[model samples]
Target: MDPWLTLAVVAGMVLAGTLLLNAIGARVKAEPLIAIVRAGLQLAALVVILKLVFTSMWLVLGWLFVMIVVAIVTSTKRIGWSREVLAAAGTAISVSAIVTVGVIVVTGITGRDPQHLLAIGGILIGNVMSITSVTAKRLREHLQESRDEIEGMLALGATPRQAAARFRGLSVSHALIPTIDSTSTTGLVTLPGAFVGALFAGSDPMDAGLFQLVVLGSILFGGAIAGTVLTQLLGAPKVLPQPPREAEEETAES
Candidate 1:
């Protein structure tokens, strides 16, 4: 396939999809077009930069740090930009990513190659970002919805953590559902991109399957860790501030 021709075909397909979506009242507002343009530009730049950076371990680590920062910014938008939120999400993502990637490197499952590091680390960080965002958002929503019950428990002399435990559990569980489902349905319901890409590169089927399993397992583990951390950080004190003493007295009187 001619590269230029393939590019033109892809651009045409994107335009047609955008037009059809607009005609159907989808109201996406040119996002798809913008995404296509951005993807092309970013990939082009990355190709040039990565070739040089891949020769040095420090350069590769720097690139991974940049990716984590980007993930943090993206997650901060979905979650709030509060200090606690940033700390929780960043710590969760960084820790989970390091642990998972470290295990892979240590076990010799994936070598110390910069290309492999970037690919696997990118996926892990992205997954952790998503899980953190979802956990934060859902935990906040749950706390809001269960305000009365939570307050009642607080009024009965329960600590904020105790009061919000149930809702926290619910939020973390909801956030983990996607990862769990993907892992459960790996070969049956979905052919993951990693597996397919490996096969396309002429890897043995068993090798591809094993590699895919490792990726899936890392994602699931990282997501669970991120979700749990986010939920734990979003206790009642973070979401529901304590009322003034006067207000508490008035409520008690009522």
Candidate 2:
């Protein structure tokens, strides 16, 4: 693709998206454009850094570590930072990345080279970060919205975890559904990035297909582990009572 053409098309697409969002009263006028610009800048920097990173195993490991830390921080911020949220998000993302990549490496599903490791590890870490953030945030929202029901369940002899089980399951399902749908529709509805990239790089069709399969599997595996582990770490919500003023107002009305 010509560089000028690429820039023109991207600019046009961004403008179109911005206009559509504005027309829909999305309330985010400039955020989408800003995010795109930021992403472009980040990718530009990554391209430069990856040149040196791909040459050294130690550098690749260090890069993965940095990715993990950024993932943790991003997830923690998204889910509302606190001691417990930080601990849960950090542990979930780190463990999921390690386990997912370790399995792929041990099974020889992907090459053990630094480039391969970075590619697969980066994908898992990124997906796990998103999964952890969505799962944790959704569970928190569910618990908050269903506070009365959860409290009633607690009063009825249900354990806190048991009371919140429905929300936890829903949150996990919500987090995993997009990945599951994407995997299910692969090749039929969409050509995944990994597969397309591999093909573009002149890999064999079979090799590209296999790599896409591995990537899809890794995404699901990492996401599931992150969601489940974060749920366990989160345990139960502490359902605090209504404030004194609200309680008295309700009492007076009753």
Candidate 3:
């Protein structure tokens, strides 16, 4: 990527940051100029690092492992359940990996190249990691926030499972929105990375389009299962874990 182009991308990302904060009615505080410089430096560092890492099989595997670890950490950090997060992440990833590899196995009958296999696996794993993280975090937060309503249902003789079921629905659906929108608006509203990247790599339009479609459908299918698993894990912190005390305090203060 060109330096100037990278600057433009950073600018666009900062705009996205502004929009994200503003969407929740948060004020758009001016981000520090050094933040952009630091981001540019980090991008340069990652590019240099990845260049060295991807050249060797051992290093490539190491890089993928690091990415998975980061994804696991990312999922856990966004939510409060410390003990269960790792377990939830590992389980979600395991289920997702099996499903993804299975899909690739079917694709293998058509004889995929090593490159295609790596690319497809990377895409599937990354999306599933995201889905898992988002699902678990949302479920935990919703359940905690809605604790009173949930317990009220429990008081009315609902089981813990029954009490938390509504939140389970809300959180999972909310978590799946991005995947759904990406599927529905693909090609029409936006060109996803799989298609655009394939074309950029000199694949034919039809071939690139097919690859994108297949990957998108596979993600939605596998993500549905992966997301559900993470949500269920979140639901089971103390065999239906209660919300963090901080969350309750924040809600009360508000």
> Top model by lDDT, which number?
2
Candidate structures ordered by lDDT, highest first: 2, 1, 3
| Of 1 and 3, the candidate ranking higher by lDDT | 1
Question: How would the candidate models be sorted by TM-score, starting from the highest?
Answer: 2, 1, 3
The models' CA-based lDDT, in order, is 0.84, 0.88, 0.73
Per-prediction CA RMSD (Å) = 5.6, 4.0, 4.3
lDDT of 1 by residue, 99-197 (tens): 888888898886578877887888889888988898888887777677788889989999999999998788888988988998899889999988898
Query: Residue 239, candidate 1: how far off, in angstroms?
Result: 4.7
On residues 60-130, what C-alpha lDDT tens digit does candidate 2 reach at each position? 99999999999999999998889988999999998899999999989998889987899889888988999
When 2 and 3 are scored with lDDT, the better candidate is 2
Worst 10 residues of 2 by lDDT: 237-246
Clashes of 2: 0
